[model samples]
Target: MTEPTSRSAPADQTQKEGSVVMQLMKHGKEVGVPSNELSSANAAADQKGQPTLEIRKDYMYRSTGRPEKTDMIKSLLTDQDASRNCELYLSASSNCSAVESSEDSEEDMYRDAEEIEREKILLCETSSSEHKVSVAPETDIMEYCRKEWRGSTPVAIRMRKGYEAVAQKFASIRRVRGDNYCALRATLFQALSQTTQLPSWLRSEDFTMLPENLLSKYDWIKQWQLKHRLGRKMGEISDEIKEYLMLLRKKWKNISEIKGPVEKQEACDKLFKNEEEEYSLYEALKFLMLNTAIELYNDDKDGRRVPVFSWLLFARDTSSNPCQLMHNHLNHIGHSGGLEQVEMFLLAYALQHTIQVYRLYKYSTDEFITLYPNDPEEDWPVVTLITEDDRHYNIPVRMCQETVL
Candidate 1:
């Protein structure tokens, strides 16, 4: 027979086909298919002039026993160029998959972090809303005392007896709400009560007490009114302070003019019970204290003496500078509950009244009374303050015909 006419693809087509074969062999090796089987598939495809894809599928599904086909496969595996190209292709593909997976992981991490931040913000807001201080109402001292005495101990018996004696002295016991402002509130309440009892003649600016004024009032008001003057002279007092003083004067006049004892009491209760007016009065009292402190500082400087204010200031903090101390104590929002014994003395001198504090202990009712001025002459028009704990003050209504200041 005539030599079978050799048939082959064009050189270019043959090169492309070779490349495809090489790729198939590389893929088969990666997927754990035997090299001999891949070689068999390729050689069989060449012999039959069949498609590479059909041969590969056939070889993959059905194992090959053709030993003669292995030479081409061994040659392809040993070829350095083919091995390098296959490795490079596989490495590039693996890198692309790794990059995409890393990007996806990075995205997941960011999403988790953002979710955590949102939770933190929500938690802080919830905490702030929960901790806000609620308004406290004034309550009876006996109710508190009853709770105290209910405990059947020796201390309880002593406390019960002491409070009973106090209760008999006063018609009623009204506790000032315990806060930084308690002492000031109790003192002001007593002052206002005393102010209400004063005759319009004595309340006037004339600084003169008539025979009629004297007849109407106790000897104490005569002295208290005569001594009472503005914390600073007229020129030195600021307009803002003037307004506060005038407002207080107006409150005194309005309360004094009220018809009956019950109505007057209601008016006073309403003023203190309302938070708005209560804080306004606190502002006034604080400003007054600051003003007094400033005047005292200036006077001390002029006299060329070591200031008592400086001593108190240095004792409390580093700076003995009056202005620095005043700014720190008065202007700071967080500096609540700083009104000390010295400041109480300042308030007493500023208001021109004696702040008499009668302290009751947990164990005993033995009165620990303190007067701000500590004058030998126990002054009338005194603000009678009672405290169970020395920190907070309350008003005890005196039983006598004399109105409690």
Candidate 2:
């Protein structure tokens, strides 16, 4: 990380010009770098004796005695509350030796904000147009159930009725791996199946060329580049998110372009089963979830009222400072443990889509189907999933299955 620049004048003659020169800062005082060696920029309002702001070439900040300038500059560039929270997060991350040590592994890389900015994928020029839903073609429900259970237990036989019941209303079950990341995987599967333009919804205005008011209500992006600075490595966090989004868009388009359902499934299998693809998606999901939590926490803290995301705050050992809890969440990425209901709700909101989960229990009530966010602001695309135990999720592909009258 480059040292922060200083704000001192060489002489009264230079000071009268209202220009600020960059100087090496150390221990709260300017030193070392010669004034002539540093670059100079004239302040717009120098004649009025107002300090001109100079944008830092990079986002790294060092802990120093002079915090007021840093605070002021960040306040101008980002949401005030989010900026403060991100500072604590970055500070904590910079000191975590474990995080810094994981730079060698491809799965545990951390990226700098400047790097992300440089490689940022421009939104497709035609992305502004409406996206069509590339619905996953239906498959045989009984065949899917048989393949899933493999005649392993008597309970599996009884569950067939519930699967049939689901089949009556839907087309087929798009199976998801029964892992800790099932919910996220299931959601992404259904979401991507719906459209190849998922990036249009997921990319933050801060990171992409998006309109400010576009989906502003559900937009969870806020100083995310800073919040997601998990490691101190130069380029450890190589934009897994950008890579993941581009690949998904490509894969969805590839699947949609296919002529047959079987061929489409084969294409999906190729992408979904790839260990590298799964890891990239998981990392991207973790990054999005972590930053979303920070945005919500900052909102709640700023409002000082009944917490909107109180469900997420409770049920966890916060240890007082919520930021520490967030830090713990960041550390747990790529580790064991499934995402919680609050997180699913957050993901649903983040995607601006409704997640409908259907229970595959032998006996269930009207609550067999549940919707995240209860009420949505728009007619967002619906992503359907089926869960036998509710702990894991699988996409339910709708198709033209003939119903037995």
lDDT of 2: 0.43
Model 1, 1-405: lDDT tens digits are 111111222333433333333432342222121112234434333222222221111111113211111111212234334433332111001122232343344334333454445545744764565332222233455665774345444545556666775665665676565545677788888777656454332255621222223224323212211111346453322334445545665676788778776677768877776665566566566655544555555544454232222233333331234444444444421133334444566677556678877656432412245566444123345777776544467787745355342
Ten-residue segment with the worst summed lDDT in candidate 2?
Answer: 25-34
Clashes of each: 0, 4
- The sequence of per-residue lDDT tens digits that candidate 2 reaches over residues 1-405 is 111112222333332221111111111010111111112221112111122222221222234211111221211223323322212111111112222222212111223343333323322322343112122235577777754544423445546767877777776665555545677777876665555343444433343212122124334332223223345443322343445545544565566667675665566666666666655666566555544454555544453221122322322333123344444444443343455444556676556677877766423554456566444334577777887754567776655563221
In model 1, state the lDDT of residue 24: 29
Runs in model 1 with CA error above 4 Å?
1-144, 152-158, 197-243, 304-315, 318-321, 332-335, 362-367, 376-380, 398-405
Model 2: how far residue 308 lies from native, Å: 5.0
lDDT of all predictions: 0.45, 0.43
Model 1: how far is 218 from its true place, Å? 41
| Steric clash pairs (candidate 1) | none
Error of 2 at 195 (Å): 0.6
- Model 1, 289: alpha-carbon shift in Å? 1.0
